[model samples]
Target: MVFTPPQNYNEIKSLLENLEAYINSPEFHEIDSLIKMPIIHYQFESIHPFYDGNGRTGRIINMLYLVQQKLLDIPVLYLSSYIIKNKNDYYRLLQEVRTKDAWEEWIIWMLKGVEITALETIKVVNKIKILMDDYKKEIRSEFSFYSHDLINILFKHPYTKIDFLQKELGVHRNTASSYLNALAKHGLLNKVKIGKSNYYINQKLFNTLTKR
Candidate 1:
């Protein structure tokens, strides 16, 4: 379905202003955040204010609104993945809202996305934490240079360079290179050279992050 938004600049601006006011208004504040969040997302997407990136901006607004309502400590819960997985339903339900005034189905679809995304995010976070702890224990047992900072830097970058380690750990360049080489020898990291620069890959962490 083709959804034509406001063609006039002033009309778009005025509508967006009203949207912002509604977000902070007492009427909106009274609604439960779970219910209001979907409404806010629908309204923002319907606005289609910018020439481009309206969908991306709308998703960002969803995270920010959750933060504002104290539903999330950080913007880690993303519904984009869920929406992408249900792409056809996502678009169909959105269009139904306009064509048939099917608000209930649209709201239910958004809430389901929220629930699935949140659960997946929690699982990923827990997995990362467990992997980090395992790495810390193994590295400490195997290497004299083991530090929590070293573990953090490895997981933080997944693919790291000698320069990154040198800067972050305030160590000499050669010292950083030696540390990385040692990890490679111990099978803790995979070392690769590309165009005169060597990089260390935390394969386990990389796998964990990229796993479906």
Candidate 2:
């Protein structure tokens, strides 16, 4: 495989220097991190320091920077989906900066992307909360001896094994297997065997998380 970057050695070196200066400079913290994220993103993509995955790495940094700056409580926002949906404009705005020095439009585009992605993230989170509540109610009503901790563990991970449930509930392997099998019978989980171990998959939570 061949890999290419937009910048040469000297250009990349200069870009790195600028990046360090920006990180330590007052302007980075003087403005809100959310407001500064777009400029930082543009610089990173323009530098294109990596042979591959520059965009992916820069996007990850965007989310990390938000957390680092305490702008977000969690890095759950799905910024890439918005960018993927508007793939053309995303690149075009970046190019506008390189060609015409259009900082305003590029920044605005990124800000809008953040806003839209944030709202989408909120909606997904609320949906998951509703699902979790429904699952709790159904589990409580369906099972006379249901463990709330078991429910927490299930939602924490969409996939669970006999060993996992056994450890979480401090029950024997047979008991754990029985619980998973019961859920499968109730249509709340699907049982699948991988090698020697069996896993119970939470279909509804998986669907909600992977919806978009």
Candidate 3:
């Protein structure tokens, strides 16, 4: 979605340009903040900047804006997952914003998602931290230094390919493979082939990420 854009659209370039101008302004979000997050969110969605992936991109922007405003310390708020569940209402409200300029209702919906998503993310972060602590305190030291680093990196990216590790950790590709392989040996990871790429997932991290 991020890479594949929609067909030619007049609003796409204008939206990106507006977003660039907004994010770049030193005092930009001050007024946005005063109106509260919902208006800002409605505005983002209403702007509908990209030719494709506008919904996903707008959700990403929402999360980033929360972090930028210090409303969140992490980007774990999966607001889109909720919006996906209410896709009909999401689209309906967006349409209302477009047709009727119904700012209040749109903003309310966004703020509600913020509150709900914030609570949900807190629960997730707490569980992940607990899992992280357990792993840090109890994992055997015999797994090697690479294994330790790989486990930690998995907390950031639950499943990763060798390229991500090589670039992020400044390790050789084989070294990254060795690290992931060690985790697989320890029964901490399951190796999976995705398309042409092989990815390793720390089982513990996946459990936290995919928990009910």
Candidate 4:
């Protein structure tokens, strides 16, 4: 019983119509198509189409649709991170689209965010993978075993905290801290002081993040 956008989105069932019709159509190259994804995303959020996780759901749909249309090879284009960084402007831009006919500005901002996000994500992913490979070749894990999921999480959140890993991997605090410290001791993570907490973000990953 998932909702689906109808034929004429602006007319009836606009939220569902806009999303379903656009995805079902072969209109990926058009500017309208490109703009439609985010527009529908904004409208979906504004309409509060779902009762729970509406914002996150809409955002996930945005990335999924982009890759569905073959515009992105991977779901690495995360505008949410960018929007999260500039929350005020994010809402304002979307509001302008709903209020005025300022398609140009909205599209411009959306496209720019897409380009910046895609390239930035690409850089980070590549760098993180490279560093992970270096770890495998240089420092082998001690006795017993470890999970390969570590590399995946490291790629997702380069600055992963011990507490976070403990929760994720279902390990004790000391074990989590040890894993993090191991990564750092082996010259993988660079301990950074962000305000109060000491973060063990991968330095090689940070290099990618900070590199233009």
Tens digits of per-residue lDDT, candidate 1, 1-212, equal 69998889899899999999988998768888888888888888888988999888888999999999999999988788888888899889989999999999999989999989888888888998998898889989988999988988998867999999899999999999999999899888999999999989999888876674
Worst 10 residues of 2 by lDDT: 1-10
Give the per-residue lDDT digits (tens) of candidate 4, residues 61-83.
88888888787787767677777
Q: List where candidate 4 sits over 4 angstroms from the true fold.
A: 1-14, 26-33, 140-212
Question: How well does each candidate superpose onto the true structure, as a TM-score?
Answer: 0.89, 0.88, 0.70, 0.59
Question: Which clashing pairs does model 4 show?
Answer: 5-16, 5-17, 6-17
lDDT of 3 by residue, 20-54 (tens): 67665776656664245555566566565555686
Model 3 lDDT, full chain set: 0.71
TM-score of 2: 0.88
lDDT of 2 by residue, 64-107 (tens): 88887878888876478888889989888887777789989988
Alpha-carbon lDDT, every model? 0.89, 0.84, 0.71, 0.71
Number of the top-ranking candidate, with lDDT as the measure: 1
**Structural RMSD, model 4:** 8.0
Clashes of 4: 3
